[model samples]
Target chain A: MKVVTKDKGVYSFSPAHKPVEYVKPGELIILETEDAVGGQIKSEDTPLESIDWSRVNKATGPIYVEGAEKGDTLVVDILDIEVADRGVILVVPGAGILGDSKFEPRVKIAEIRDGLVLFDGLRLPMRPMIGTIGVAPEKGEIPTATPHRHGGNMDCVEVMRSARLYLPVFVDGALFAAGDLHAIQEDGELCVASIEVEGRILLRFSLIKHKAPEWPIVELDDHYSILTADEDLDKAVKLASEQAVKALMRAKGWPFEKAYMFGSIGVKLAINQGVDPKKGARAIIPKTLVTLNDLLIESD
Target chain B: MKVVTKDKGVYSFSPAHKPVEYVKPGELIILETEDAVGGQIKSEDTPLESIDWSRVNKATGPIYVEGAEKGDTLVVDILDIEVADRGVILVVPGAGILGDSKFEPRVKIAEIRDGLVLFDGLRLPMRPMIGTIGVAPEKGEIPTATPHRHGGNMDCVEVMRSARLYLPVFVDGALFAAGDLHAIQEDGELCVASIEVEGRILLRFSLIKHKAPEWPIVELDDHYSILTADEDLDKAVKLASEQAVKALMRAKGWPFEKAYMFGSIGVKLAINQGVDPKKGARAIIPKTLVTLNDLLIESD
Candidate 1:
């Protein structure tokens, strides 16, 4: 078992960065993560303007996996996520879906105990999830705050423990990185931030050779979601829906028309993170209808 | 109980139409509805081009409720949905999210028995819902295929039995109509059609005088979703999120910031229908956090 500490973090995902640790396929590893704000907000009384914005969204190590190469799909199984005792949620002045609305910069520190998030005498269900996770892209560097085909900062709710994330591999050895844990987050992450927390994730990686999806996919118990991001949700949803329909067509060995019609009865489209500049959307296909093999297309 | 038969249906919702039935606020009524295609696709062998497109989406009634008037919110509780033994699904040549894509005008009829929608050896979960339900608008007419503040063909999955739908009243008596039943449908309704079925809906309407929202809303067991539709999903989602944040602000009596921040941890943004010309989106807020009173703004 290997463990990458929180101190080793990267501000962006790029092939230029050296791998912090290297492991063989099927090897189990642990990733220690810092909060999205880089632990800058110490308490509710902490001034919001004092923190450095550039240092925010620091993701932990690009752990390279042997045998993971370009034209392959990196399957990372998230086994467990253990969050810290406390987390923070913030409201920024000009960030979020409601950017034009005026608001005082406020921060609230929440307690995490007994598998519940306690805020103002209310107990919220704890649904721990990874907020930022990605591998190096084929070409350029992507900031930790954005999500692209290579998967960065896709604050998707399904990226939780007991789910398997399928990221398209690019660059040899597959420099993978993940951080920004949330104790509990709803689908949209509407106000720009969630109950951001420090945590440790236990995961294992495997490779699907010569097959990769156009975008990242998350496999859960009953469904697989195709994730996409663009400057707006319309483009993202269109791409996700198209890819999902294609996968369904392949799975059922049917023409595009039948698959397209059947998708209305089975596939669900949702927003993952609405507040980011590149809004994230997903097309969730039921496992009863499609499979992992259907989503990944072989690249000749 | 008064019953509105399927034969007395209207193609468009307008203030110019005559009310078929009248009832008190608390009185329950049954609405007999035709399928989205006006019950024309009787079997899989039926040609898709044979059906009259102009007769599609015929709502059963413009039921007038006593004491219901303009500037009021009409709250209708969906008691039960009794679907017929058969349903039809279709893929029109150019009538879906993938409208531009080439496809044959295909039609498929499904069997509904033992509380299940059986389609081609697959037993889909029966989640019968209202596809088109609305009151007459303040002025002019809106075709039943489009959704707006008046709540026409929202295609929202949550508009099922046990849910409560809130529609804003425009003209006096809240001239309400509901039809277009779906035996089962996913969130996006990605394709043009779903398991369209004829059904009977049992519902009762109550009113909140002088209190109305900017859009229609659906109240499920654990959450309330504000529904909005626009030419694009981005605009719909933007308006929905802002309204949800505003509701939170009223619920907790907190200034804009705290409610906006907490909304990130509590609210969800989702698509109800993507195929319609006006894409429908919603902001689902947890019932544990906000009450229905918070959503109904005083119009006076």
Candidate 2:
């Protein structure tokens, strides 16, 4: 068991980034995270425009998992999330889809209590989710705000409690970082922001040697999803669909055409988020249609 | 009650297309439908390349609803669907996301019996849906293959039994056409086709005078969705999001920003289909999130 608290988080996910903690597989670790803005906006009086943009989206740690080699799959199962008393939401002009339009930046403080996030007398059920979680890439550095094969700020809401996220290891001792917690967010996060909160996350890690996928895969209670993020949503969706088709092919021992046909009528494509930096599309294949045993690895 | 049987279906949706039968509002109608390929591909011997593309996607009727004038909303409530004994699925080499990649054109006939579509020794529960359904446009013709404001070929799987579809009326008599039945389809319909089948459909129509949305809206058992179709999936998603925001604004009597914020975390965005002449996106707003009274129409 390890409890790692890195106050100074990294602004990017890179192989060059130093690991804050080292732990073996089959271990439980606790991570304390800062908000997406790196704790810049404190209260209602905090001016949104005054925050430094370059210092935002700081991820907690590149926790090195021992014995995790390149091409391995890092299974990070979410155990629990404990949110702070307050969360921040900002409407920054020129940052999201509403960018181009001019308006005074607005900041609001949400109180997290009684299993709800209360803002301006409106109550929203608390569904805490990690907005950024990834492993170090093999090549150039990718900003924590961008999402790619290495899985940066995907902002997918489905990566929540009890979900198992599988990340492909690109370097030896897979450098994993997780932060940017949100109390609640819809599928699109269309406002370019969610109810950002600081929280402590509990995760259990396991390594599947040589079983890594090209992108991230999330196994939820009801379905398994292949998450793909690209600036162009069409391309993202295509990639996700291809990944699902590939999974079907590998699992069912079917040819490409047969797999493609099955995917067309069996896979469900969901939009994780469709605005700015990266547009995410998740191809969700229901477990009822394809059991986990069917998706078992042939070798690895 | 009115029974309209138009064997000669139309390939396009047009304001000029004559109505096969005219009926008063609140009347029930029974219409028989052809498949997406217009029932041309019969068996294994059917040549995939020789089928006429011009005659594809044949919708049974532009059955007119009397007193359904422009600016009114045509409410088509799907009551029932009776699928045929057999259905067809095709993997045309040049069609869908598989385009540019070469593969032998494959066709499979699925047996619809005992409430399942049996194909390749696999049984899929029959979830018959109307793939193409729309009202006439205001001006030019819209092909039944394309989904637009007039709601042509949406190809959404949610438009199934017990759902209510709202289409904006643009002509004196709302000319509603529906066909392209599918025995079952996943969300994306990635292979460009589903279990295409000929079927009989029962619909009940009602006119909401001077209260219509610019785009198509579907009221499912649990949620309301605003459907948008564009070649670019991103733009389509944006449009759908905006529509959901608009609904929230109109329904909750909130300002634009408040509605947008509510929509960001409360609504769900789904990809109806991402590969084709039209990339479909649906912003699904759960009924639990917004009450019907909040979505009250301000005007047509």
Candidate 3:
């Protein structure tokens, strides 16, 4: 099938967006997406407020894949990210985790020069990835600021190119929307900004028919990440551990007690987003240390 | 000149408790301190309402160091840790970040088996370090649970052997107190309970005259860590960045604005402790990444 071009603003997921009508396990779909700001902020733009907020973080089309059911998992294979011309921007404003008083008005722009993100006389190797990508939430329209079960605004740097993000399907057609492309960002993006740039995001999606998790479970090549949020870091970790245990139970058919015990023995926790002061804390638990072979579950 | 051994009775750091005489920097001091529970709960002790709340987290003596005055930095180098032949126990009750509802009565004992901390069938490589060690607050005596500028209960895992922690001297003689040794603990010790053990803590202190931070700073072989505690992670990172900027400014002689801009260009922020639940959020900026050469400060 021919890939969709940019002129077609409204791309249908069934035939136009997805490369193939039916996606097999480990299948790939390289869907290209626009930048988070949607060309609102340009290099010549002086004041940041000149950019409209309503159009910011406008995601790509809802990439619908065949055989992606509610209980299935959509493995988004982020193959490659290419910056055509303009680079990303890092802005600190009143809306983010850092309130107005702490941050002064400053805009840091990046230029993809010689395959590197050049910012303020420093060259940062670009590792581009989608900042916000998720299926529709159950209740109200979730903003791009918060990360939910749908896997929006995860901002985890490890989910860069070549990483596989396993998102649980919610609504029919999965209604996957992805954008907010970043050139490079630290784990928490504590500044509430990154080298946000206009780039083309290419990702392939595959369908895995498994029981849906209560939340999103991301699996990179060597690591398994469980997204969890809580009022505090301690509670966030506990909630993450609980989610890990639940994932373990689902994957291994072990009892809750056994999963809990096993987690205490082997599970290691990592903080994903600690700088977002208001919404409590967010973290991810990688399953690299915990082997499926060690569990009671049989591999496919 | 001579190191003092354990004194009889519970060693307390209160004003009423006897002060341990000072030694020069780089001199080893062996201290014997009660567990965080302060002997209220023993090996076989069960959770009960009779526990003394004030006695909990009672620190050892305020080992007054010789030549340690205000404006000097106390470099506490952890030398060694040796748990008693018996063991230690961990209990989850009113302690930790979890509320009373999630509280459960459970105990796990630790034993040194095969050079590893053994609890039931689990064998964890021992990484022993004092949990609470700091100078008396400038204003008055502060509880060990609340970590402050004095470095009480930082619960930083990096404070292990070979890692030198620089504490700011507030009062004369730098009244140093140390206790709450844990055999092994994850970053946050989320349960608020690590393998709490009664172990002999051996530490050497070195005085860096005329060099003290507003808050404590930790230095390992490869990285420098700034300690800051705030309700929000973003604020904590900002505090850490501010400290790093100041350090860079002092080291390079750059203006504050230049230092801040330089930091944005170079430094990498890491989430130090997102598990503390209460004080879990910490950010570490790598000194190597910052352009120290641009700053006009001299390096020692």
Better of 2 and 3 by DockQ: 2
lDDT of 2 by residue, A1-300 (tens): 788785847989899988999988878999999898888988877976789988788888889999998878889999998889898887766655554445567777789998898866678799999999999999779999998888899999988989999888889888999999999998888878888888999999998876677789889988988889988888888888888887887777888788778777788888888775888888899886665444434334
TM-score of 3: 0.82
**Candidate 1: Cα lDDT at A187:** 85
Model 2: residues >4 Å from true position, as ranges?
A: A288-300, B6-8, B289-300
User: DockQ for model 1?
Assistant: 0.78
C-alpha RMSD by candidate, in order:
1.6, 2.0, 5.1
The docking quality of candidate 3, as DockQ, is 0.26
Name the lDDT of candidate 3: 0.59
State the lDDT of candidate 2 residue by residue for B1-300, as single tens digits: 777674857888888998889888888899899888888988967988779888789998888899998888889999999889999988887677655566778888888999998867678789999999998898889989999888988999989999999888889888889999999998888889899999899999998887787689889878988889999888888888778877877766767666666666788888887766888888899886666444435463
| Cα misplacement distance, residue B136 of candidate 3 (Å) | 1.2
Candidate 1 chain A lowest-lDDT run of ten: A95-104
Using Cα atoms, each model's DockQ against the true complex is: 0.78, 0.67, 0.26
Per-residue alpha-carbon lDDT of candidate 3 for residues A91-190, written as tens digits (9 for 90 to 100): 4445333334344555545677776877555577776767776775544566655566677766666667777677777555676766667777655554
Angstrom error of the Cα, residue A99, model 1: value is 1.2
The iRMS of model 3 comes to 4.4
